[model samples]
Target: MSTTTIRVRAPSEVDDARTGPATGRLRRRIADNLTAYGFLCAALVCFALFSWYPIIRGILLSFQQVNFVTAPEWVGWQNFATLFADPLFGVAWRNTLLFTGLALVVGFAIPFAVAIVLNELRHAKAYFRMVVYLPVMLPPVVVAILWKWFYDPGPGLFNSMLRAVGLPDLAWLDSTDTSMLSLVLVATWAAMGSATLIYLAALATIPGELYEAAELDGANLWQRLRHVTIPQTRFVLLVMLLMQIVATMQVFTEPYVMTGGGPEDSTVTVLLLLYRYAFTYNDFGTASAMSLLLFVFLGGFSALYLKLTKSGG
Candidate 1:
């Protein structure tokens, strides 16, 4: 009789254990769904308010002649047509490409190279990094002002140094020929810090075992860099290249503050042109159209980069 009672109790306990877990799992599922839905609803509201709304409004503005006071006139493709016909549009596009190329060469490559060098340095690492990054932390206005003073043709640090060295005092920012290059230098100086930090992080992630293996194989510094370091950091380099392209294409502040798109509109970038159309001329339609064009260009390159990376992977 005692044995039979014990068997009955064991069956009841097993049933309870199974039911309890099922009930707990159901409760957890409900909680998770509620949390996910809550976040989704919040994200949708924010997107509707900020991102999607402005994009739709900008697209509409691109088709309409909108001055601040009057009702916007539906102009169809007139704005785009006008943009293509405008001579400055060509200059803006050309300057944008040139600047991106220059930035890639001087700004992107130099900082990556600096990061690699710093990674190899075993001593004074913190001091060297701080010194290299100090210029980037300075206010943009301060950087622009300081560079402008140094770039001055007469009695400027640059020209004075050149003169002292018995070299020609070439007009750096004053000339249409060299204004873009001069701005590139300043931009590279100011932006190198962010790139260096990213690259240092990437370098740190590389497995030490790989380096040790390369050393055992009698690989020199150049061979190790080419075979090991580069392969490990290829993704980072690609990401940086795309980022640099995007940033360089949207360049405005330095050129605007330094040259004012001057020396005969030679330094006029797309952003500068957009600013002129929107604020300087009060032509919202054309400005929106120009902005749309720039957006499409950037989007295309970004998509291409993604596709290439995916294919490579």
Candidate 2:
């Protein structure tokens, strides 16, 4: 056999070899953690400055009268009392509730129906989806302005169409009876696209086998939708319902832009009233109180909803 040779590494050399990569890896890991934490801290600081600060400041302002010219004056529950005494307060709240209810009924169902139709369509889906989502992509102010034009009592697009059909022109935005409903329709049209897309995504996630099984069992189209599709999308439906409620309850844009809280104040919403208090009336205290009330109501409602849904699940 050829002569065998063996080389022994020194203990120091062995230790250095063993520790070199480990040390480098440890340093890299520490650096990565530091970088990640730095980003997170930056995000926290931004949120603190913007969101938390605003919320805290509003709460404090709710108990104090602060006009830009004068120093803030502390008043205990006076702003709330003022709100209670104001007659328009009750009307604003009632109209806000009415808008939320009407928007929910119309805005909620139409999106789901549209999503279902889109999911079923096999031809030119991309084109149709673009059409549906076009409104959502447009700026809210532009949409409100465009619809305002459409709702014009004379020579408006809707009135023109009505006249073409030999029907009398309805006072869409002028009459109190139709004003809130008109706002609701505009809100629905503008906001429904996003909800429809979400429903479509949820529908797509549903397994196809269930539908095939339903068909084999002689279930009709409605039965398939009722049994297979609905149960599968129940979670999405509940979540969207809550979000829609919250969003509609805070509606201000359409009413402020189109109606200006008019038609006998029938279209006034909570946010529109809050805006008036802060800007028009120069009463920041009352505006803060209105905001606080809205926040509390929404927080409690959301908590209760989550609890109920958790238990049901």
Candidate 3:
């Protein structure tokens, strides 16, 4: 008796309400896709003009010889062969590898350790972080100049202090043996600030409750750090490590400005050698060949980084 008065709405009415808007929305989405694809096509065109063209040109240049006024002549792999046979090239390679290895050990480790220490500080955290990160804001040229003055052979701040304190005034950047080490120290000092800031950010993201529980369970500071802090920050640390390795591999300005490839080509990095070949020697083909080789090394590192990141995830 109660259900006898029921009324039904037409299916068309419901369909009109939902389907009209949905169809309109679908049309808008198709229009949006068209606009997006149009922009992507424009970007591709720009990239071809600016980026791809130059890379293609460089590749071509690597196989040819040209004077300033003449058209380039195809010389095949002669330039690459000559570059590999160059006596200085071997020295440059060895020094570059040494500097990179030293930077990884000294530069990378110091910042990570300092960041971990800073994260544990309960008071003046902001001030400490600011102090640590301030150096990264300074220009690299300024950093190199400051270190140059400090490392001056005589009456320099470093040697003068040593002399004042009745110690030997060691040749900081002048000696071939210590020149690379001095450069590494400056680079480490300049770079550690940013690395510390990154590590600090990573450390802050770790949950507070984990530390509280660890402490409650009678874990000491070292134990807590080993068990909790390091594990949590390992991913960020690996990412930073790979980035640093890539950057350090291309080191040029520090050696170029500081020592001009040093007392005995002691600090001549691979990039510096490439620059020397291009500008100083005017051997474009050889320089381009070296550039390609350097690119390959970097590409290998990048590929490794991607593989490790995927596996870690």
In model 3, what is the error at residue 123, expressed in angstroms? 3.6
Per-candidate alpha-carbon RMSD to the true structure: 4.6, 3.8, 5.8
Residue 297 of candidate 1: its Cα lDDT?
A: 90
Indicate the residue-level lDDT of 267 in model 1: 91
Best prediction by TM-score:
2
Return the top candidate by lDDT. 2
Off by over 4 Å in 3: 1-23, 37-50, 308-313
Model 3, position 19, has a per-residue lDDT of 79
For model 2, what is the error of residue 177's alpha carbon versus the real structure, in angstroms, after optimal superposition? 0.9
What are the per-residue Cα lDDT tens digits for candidate 1 across 208-286?
9999999999999999999999899999999888988999999998888999988898899999999999999999999
lDDT of each residue in 1-313, candidate 2, tens digit only: 7998999999967876888977867877999999999989988999999999999999999999988789999997999998888888899889988998998888999999999999999999999999999899998889999999999988799999999999999999999999999999999999988999999999999999999999999999899989998899999999999999899989999999998999889888889999999999999999999999999999999999989998998
Clashes of each: 0, 0, 0
For 1-313, candidate 3 gives per-residue lDDT tens digits of: 3556666768966766677987867877999999999989988999999999988888888888854557788999998999888999899889988999999988988998999889778899899888888878899988898899999977689988898889998888879889998999989988889899888889889999999999999999889889999899988988898888888888987998899997878999999999998898888888988888888889997998889888977
Q: How accurate is candidate 1 locally (lDDT)?
A: 0.92
